[model samples]
Target: MRQSPNDLTPGGQQRRAAIIDAAAQLFNEHGYHQTSTAMIAERVGCAKATVYHYFRQKPEILFEIHDQWIEELSAHVADTSDDVPLSEFLRQVFRDILQLMETKSDHVRVFFEYYRELPDELRAVATSKRDHYERVIESRIRTGVDTGALRPQHPRIAAFALFGMCNWSYQWYRPGHELSDREIADELFEIYFAGVRAESPASP
Candidate 1:
């Protein structure tokens, strides 16, 4: 009988997390198609059947990685208070992403690079979650514009630009480098904010 992942005991949950982390690292290092269930099982120091016991198939594992990555990113903006200044709010959001990237670099890579590898149904779910996250950023940008905190611009395009800046950082960002994640985050926010902030009225 197949055991449900939801019914996992605490130890079982830890084992499952290990499997996912191992798979994320392997998938990040090797392309999704190149990686196999056996490889994942070996990385987890368990039998392939044990891997299957946790996840019915590789795509389920892939989807789990995608879910974890997106869920963490979503959490940064979830239930954000409007009272928070727009600049500080967005700055903190980017800061959080950089910090997460530092800690979960492997998962972050799989998220941006291997999303299409998910099966159609899983891909759709991931796409929906990803799109929702983008909308949250867009909503915040629109609010900034409406509130005169940001310049009048297409919120959707601006949102994409913001994502482009932070999302691509995983490609080059590394911890224990010249700049810490927070410093990099602040620099990115300043650069992004410079472009989007409401322009001052011309000298009268």
Candidate 2:
């Protein structure tokens, strides 16, 4: 019996997902400029045209993957409460980013590699989303400064430095190695906070 589109069985859904997954993996491994749609189709065991049916072009597929990843990251960061101390909040933020990178390594690779390839309009959109994430860190730094928890410094610069430290981890962080994500987060936080935290209050 011929099945309608709505009647696709579990196997069909799995196959579709497999195609997307394969494309994402290949794009990450080889970079967008290097990976061809034909390669993606071959990896997915589908015709090149079929790959087009799912994604109009390589850039569209890359955008889709990036969109999904940023959405999830935004949600994770949004869930953090304002009540938490700055240090704890920063810890959670780092942990969330590390966990996402560890689990979605391919997406992370594609995100970093293809960011500049996006059109100006799309680049603006992507940057806006990223800036939203950065604002959270910036706000925390500002709060710490206001409360005298951290040394007085330019919040924006401090925030950028913290983000740079965390974001660059994708370059060298390897999964299944000795250091767990939590350990990496802890070490990173230690290095960052030790430098930024205010010195012991002058003896009263």
Candidate 3:
């Protein structure tokens, strides 16, 4: 019988985790289509069959990457409520996403770059998760509008704009001595919530 991720022994579990980590790096460096199980095994210091023992195929690994991102992000925002000010809520989102992207940079890179390559069924599952996340953001934005904590705009579009701004960090974000994720998130939120141009007298 194939061992489920949770059913692995202690050592087996370690190898499985290592395989995912190595696969993420390899997938990020080489596009998903270009990466092979052999490459992942080599990176993990194991035989190619070991990867299959854990994941049925490369696409399963890709789907797992997407699953990890969505689940963690979902859990992070599960406590959100209108009781919190919109600014605080949005700032938290910015902070969380930036933290995840910074720490799991390789995973972020692979998720953005390879999710589309998943099989149709896996892709559907991923899309459902993505949509659910967007809906939560939209719902929060609507509440913010009703409570006058945020400006009026199409909530769905606003959610897309926010994610688009943050998700692209995978392309060029580099952690260094220059700035911290919080600082970057601060700048990003300031730009997102506050317009660049001066507000006109009649704006309100």
Candidate 1 residue pairs in backbone clash? none
> Residue 79 lDDT in model 1?
62
Winner of 2 and 3 under TM-score: 3
What overall lDDT goes with each candidate model? 0.87, 0.78, 0.80
Choose 2 or 3, whichever is better by lDDT: 3
TM-score of 1: 0.93
145-186 per-residue lDDT for model 1 (tens digits): 877778889999999998899999999998889999999999
- Model 1 regions lying over 4 Å from their true place: 1-6, 200-204
For candidate 2, report its TM-score. 0.84
Where model 2 places Cα greater than 4 Å from the true spot, the runs are: 1-17, 200-204
The best-first sequence of candidates by lDDT reads: 1, 3, 2
Candidate 2 lDDT score at position 158: 92
Model 2 residue 37 CA deviation (Å) reads 1.8
User: Which predicted model would earn the best lDDT?
Assistant: 1
lDDT tens digits, residues 1-101, model 2? 12232456677756656766787799777877888989998998889987766566676666666776777878976887777777788778778878877
